[model samples]
Target: MNAFRTLATIVGGSLKNNATIECDDHGAEFFKVEINSSMDKAINHPDLTFLQGLSCRDSSSSTFGPLTLAQLSHFECGEVALSFCMLHKVGDACSAYYFLRDWARLTRDPKSTLSPPYFAMDSLMPSPFDGPMVSPVVEPKMEGCIHQRFIFSESKINALKVLVVAESCWLSGRIEKLPHLFPNSITMMVLSFSGLTEDPMPILEMLPNLRNLDLFRAYEGKEIISDNNFSQLEFLHLTELEKLKRWLLGTNVMPLIKGLGIHNCPNLKEIPQRMKDVELLKRNYNKW
Candidate 1:
């Protein structure tokens, strides 16, 4: 409990200060922790059913400010499971992963040096637009949603890969009405493809609502440049681009971007000077 409380202080942002999210405003902040005892041993359940009793559920309509819920479950075999639920409005999956990673590091060695977490709510919500916001898809009600879990074993994954390899073909030509086809897509991830030689920003910036993008070994280029676009983009992550040496951005590009993460780009020596104005920028390099 003490460890988690300290984690909250480190990564909870406004919630650490007891701020809440309101209907028309933002203010009451609370972080809830619950502990439970289970008679069943974790070894008996190889499936995800074991998590059913170790997690907490939250509602979107709740007035809780920056909701961060944690559950600790103790089993008969003396094993413990810790679960955390963070509101999507407060942080995304990447944010959660780093938060948990830092927490584990802290628990292992309390005196170890840690990278600080960045919070940019003020930068994210600079000003409210005066008209009704337009959305490409209708929002679904949480009450009508059903939750289910699917597990894919190594054998199953290997079989699927074989089938995909047998049936796959290369595609060419420009795709029309791309935004109309994927209007609701807010996040995109690309990995392990080395054929892309041109800068991908021109095509990707065409995405009307894309907010988060992650690229890992997806391009085989020496340089990347971006124009003055990506008006709605908020976060960009670049990783393992071994050939990339330079990245340049035009003026007023990615106007709303709040965070940029770079990792394992050995040849990329410097980040854009303009990126210094962003609220959060994290870079990890293997070598200069």
Candidate 2:
């Protein structure tokens, strides 16, 4: 209780009730739970679900106010699991990461100095819409929800690529309208992890699922983008690869990239004439 009291003081700041929860009629409240259990048993429990098992908070019971909850479960094998539930009204993914990181840091070293969470965003955004907001804190019972997992081995991936490549027609789309939300996005870290040196064309030819690609520090000698590649990509970013001396873009390659960012590539020589037909050749033309 003493330790928790201190923790609540640290995390909750000056606000008494859960900070960001606002129900239609009610105001704000706090919820917390803690338990110690065998990690192996919990992991293998058939009926125990991920969300409820992790949270263990009675969110279904109306708190009569805004709600903030935390759950901590300690396993016998020295593994500790912690969960925090807060509304999107509170923060986004980056904020969640920082909160978890600092919380863990403080739990390890109670006296650790911490930087204040940035509330500067609060000032820029307009005042919250003046109306009753439906709180989705309590998850509704999901009916007919089937959860399944599949492992895609190297062989399976290659088979899928071969199947996609068999199509004789190449189709492309233009961006007449853009969506406000991007649910599927990929980053350049995927490229850096591949450890490919000669060219990045083969991977592009194989994978067609991505719509956004951010490739950073790719040390490939030449980036050869053929037409009919990256047909669905809308956003592209390349950065910090000196070895990238030439770029060949085919007319059918990347026909729909509306946002493009290139940085720190002193050796990059050329771009596609139409920015769609990308082709590469070595030249001392000092391509920017």
Best model number under lDDT: 1
RMSD of 1: 17.0
Taking the tens digit of each residue's C-alpha lDDT, what string does model 2 give over 1-288? 333344344333322232333223222223343335566676677222133533323433334223334556555567767666544445566765776687788888888877766755655454457522233233545578788999899999999766544422221232222222322222221243233465655455434555556555544555645545676766665666666767776656766667666677787866555654333222222522
Q: Say which candidate scores most in TM-score.
A: 1
For model 1, the superposed segments whose C-alpha errors exceed 4 Å read: 1-186, 191-194, 279-288
Listed in order, each prediction's TM-score against the native is 0.34, 0.32
Candidates' C-alpha lDDT: 0.59, 0.50
TM-score result, candidate 2: 0.32
Clashing pairs counted in every model: 5, 17
